[model samples]
Target: MTATGAGQAYGIEALNVWCGLARLTAADLFAGRGLDPERLDNLMMSERSIGLPIEDPVTNAVNAARPLIEALPPEERARIELVVTSTESGVDYSKSLTSYVHKYLGLNRHCRLIEVKQACFGATAAVQTAVGYLASGISPGAKALVIATDVAVVDEKAEYSEPAAGHGAAAMLLSDRPRVLAMDLGAFGNYSYETLDSARPSPRFDIADVDRSLFAYLDCLKNAYADYAARVTDVDFTRDFDHLVMHTPFAGLVKAGHRKMMREQGVTGPRIDEDFARRVAPSLIYPGAVGNLCSGSVYLALASLLDSGVVTAPSRVGLFSYGSGCSSEFFSGIVDEQSAATVAEQGIGKRLEARARITFDEYLAVLEHNLECLVPVENRTVDPAEWEPLLDRVGDRPEILTFTGVKDYHRQYAWR
Candidate 1:
């Protein structure tokens, strides 16, 4: 009963996705570490299951949201006033992806749907907006579902890109009363002029370029810490929060930022380092292992943290969301003890552990797959076990189910 009362507020529930990591069998990553040929075959099969267009990050996100929304109770589902989709991958220039999701999910025709575009910070912005909507008294039993999903496909030939490319999605149900925690919207962080260059072009379609050097990233963290320190005078930075959730593009980057912030602020304590290691560090390992999922990356990390029991009710949680247009936001929330146990039991850990790992070669094959085709042929076979029949059609109309194997060296799809 810490501040938000005994009823549920905003909370995240189930998450589902098709990622590069989900393509391999358990033996691939855990047992053989991607060496077994059988595991590789399975990986190839998985890549061929969804079809070429499904290989992209945005498609994975959009597909994942469909079932999640469908699973909600009618009453709860109807209460959703908005559907916010955060993504960097978009094929449409004019229409918002949220509109597509809205139509696909068969949501209330009058509900507001929007796509937020602040790089990785988009979902966080959506979450903040949901909180405001709840506070504003728009509808009784009002709720908002924020979905973040992405597929990070990196070019193997790229020098700077990590081999850990992946794809996944997460869904959060936001409301008032008896939930994870009451969100505390605090002051926003400022961006530095030098940080603007972080988003440079790369051979890989998924990864973004970091503008600052290691030192510069640290310097930005120091600036962020200073900004936070100036606003909140009462809470102890180290002990107040159970864990600090960070925007982790990579594991080492977050650790480096934390060390720099602690050093510059002259705040040295065992609790700080302990918190950084035991809580913060582990929270980010999912991203390191799975590659960056763009907008979905941070929320995926948050789900991992909650799953591991590193975060609990009544504990304060600090969240740092950074988007490489170089904007960042620092906020905190207090977990509600009532629903903490329930929400934490949502089984995100099992889902993460259940992912399949593909080899570097298979990943390359997946990346090379072509998506812009109207017809399918027998030569389109990539993997027999994984491919689904596709329908060929004219214009933007839904095509007929034709060829059934992998095309363009990628997976093929079949409609139900």
Candidate 2:
């Protein structure tokens, strides 16, 4: 009895996503720090990194969601009753990122706009919250928009964690008649606690005690998986689930977490390695390419799996989500029949290919500009004549929300 045919009423309908990566290689990241190449290779196991120049969390969210929102039938798009954005990279303290997303998407004015924050777990929380809202029947037949967006800022000086830093965002639509995947509402488990293993006390910097954070991640995975195992009673991570997706802070940690989870389910040694190589490792393609997406990592992994064509109707896909400071959840969702068909039609690969690559020097300049933007200066205004030509250098991608500049102590953005 797998969680395959549970007849879920609410689940993901479509996933519209975008990743803004400036083309700097992992070698470039290490070279910037004057670090050992071999060590960086082992830690990150990633080939490329992405950089964002004028894109903030808001623009990232808009770029991620706009395509899908526009593809929605006029009626389906109009029925959107809620917008939830989850990010630790939020630009505004009082105003939720949803305000920008709502306005840019031209969503109905009556939609509820809220943001969720709990380190990397915020997006998963937002997704679960959306599911709950749908279940509440407050707005039956209306859909919910949930976006997990973040830009992992790189501090080249920080050798231990900088290589894996990446910037990306994912937007998902949830409703009862999901065209993507139908979640098993009953097969869910969650765990949370307080720990300072990782944090971004400063908006631009991420401080992590690497060892402690990995330990906390493993602990959260253990507790959440235990809770899920107890509830399902018949799940075999190697057999019952077609794919296993986890929040990838980096590639190595995900491999370690997969081994640990397999060992606990009474599978170990060669068998654990085998299952991970086949079932789990495939999900890492996107992360392995794009690097860490902060809150967007897990869903990005899911999108990678969907693109792989291995998941099909009735296949159970297990997901383990972790957020440092710290929380975790273990859940499984069944693939709907239309999921693979929908995924095949998606433009994720095309978008990734279309991103403009920047040189190592260019990447550094972008970061420096972001750092400069951080120091608030009162009454600082940009003359459009002076900045527009510079902003145009970032390329003109259609429908992409570009961070124009700041005026009156407010950050400004416009669509490209």
Candidate 3:
């Protein structure tokens, strides 16, 4: 059965998203170690060596969500109904990182909080859940906060998954008023097996064959889209959306999926007009630069379009989210006016432009540093001159302190 809903009063209002590199480009990695640049150069030229930037997923999630929380009027902040975080970057196996986020961001103490795990589609699920909550009249006039974050770590030993991976984060604030668009959820399907561990390592921790994973993904895409088409009605797939925002694990896959969808739906000629190119032009393919952030990838792209002004209120946006092991969903929504303006004015575009590009060697250094042993101590002092106040920490953690850092990890902050 298909799930469908329409509402002019509920939609996404504003999104504060951020992308960054904790270190440098991957090309610099070989240079820093005095390794042969010839091999690296050849790799880059062949399209196999393009490396995405590395950022701490936790930090990115926190950073992206901070602005949204801070921008909320004080009265609204106190009434937040939910905080949903989607990630593949949880710090510990047992802990729900959302709890830490709630504590750090000073969200309402009464908030209903949870984490979502469905590969890259987790946040989309959260968005759908928020809609259901609103539809059920559970949180009247209250807002739902959704955040997606991940650091794509390429498995060096894997040949196929390397080129397409990256890292990044995105955040969205959904409320009942000032609705931007109507959301309709379509066919959902999942393919599972006891032995499929291609996208991730097995519990015993062995890398499954990359080719097997790729083939499975292709098959899953075909199946999911076919199901979605058969199920959706009253919307012409070809003419309705000016854009199709597919969950991109890599740049090429998105194109493949779009082509497949068009071919299957029998769309052609003027019907396929310039809107296709214009809509897809702003496609957010951060994974090529940020790696695969799992749940955050698709939403990050949506935020990118909103932040860049490619999408405005009343625009119909098509979103396709996929999760490996494996589930897929196709959904569409319209943008709201005030939300669009708030997003445009929030300076997200500026923040993305302000990021510093690092060399491969530098990125490796940061990763190594992060992985390396550090002196453990409590009550670390942050340089007030370096850190800026991103959020007001509430509750019983030692009094909060502010410090400066590169807005996206160029600098470091320690709570004093």
As for lDDT, the candidate ahead, 1 or 2, is 2
lDDT of 3 by residue, 33-83 (tens): 455555443222111111121234545666677777887789988878889
The lDDT values for all models are 0.54, 0.77, 0.57
TM-score, cand. 3 vs. native: 0.75
lDDT per residue as tens, model 1, 1-416? 12322343444434443332244322333232334444332221112111233344334555556555666788878888878888665434455657655655678876888777666667877877777777676586777878775544344333333333345656666776525556654533444433553442322343344445344455655566557656665545555667777776656567767766666557676755775777586566556545556666666666556555555457667777777665566767765444335445544444445443445344344456532222223345434234232212111222222223444433344432
Off by over 4 Å in 1: 1-53, 66-68, 186-220, 268-273, 336-346, 370-416
Best-to-worst TM-score order: 2, 3, 1
The alpha-carbon deviation from the true structure for residue 313 of candidate 2, after best TM-score superposition, in angstroms, is 4.6
Model 2, span 201-269: residue lDDT tens: 877677888889989999988889778877876866667777888998787898888888777779867
Those runs of model 2 whose alpha carbons end farther than 4 Å from true positions after fitting are: 2-8, 372-396
**TM-score for each candidate, following the candidate numbering:** 0.73, 0.92, 0.75
Candidate order by lDDT, decreasing, is: 2, 3, 1
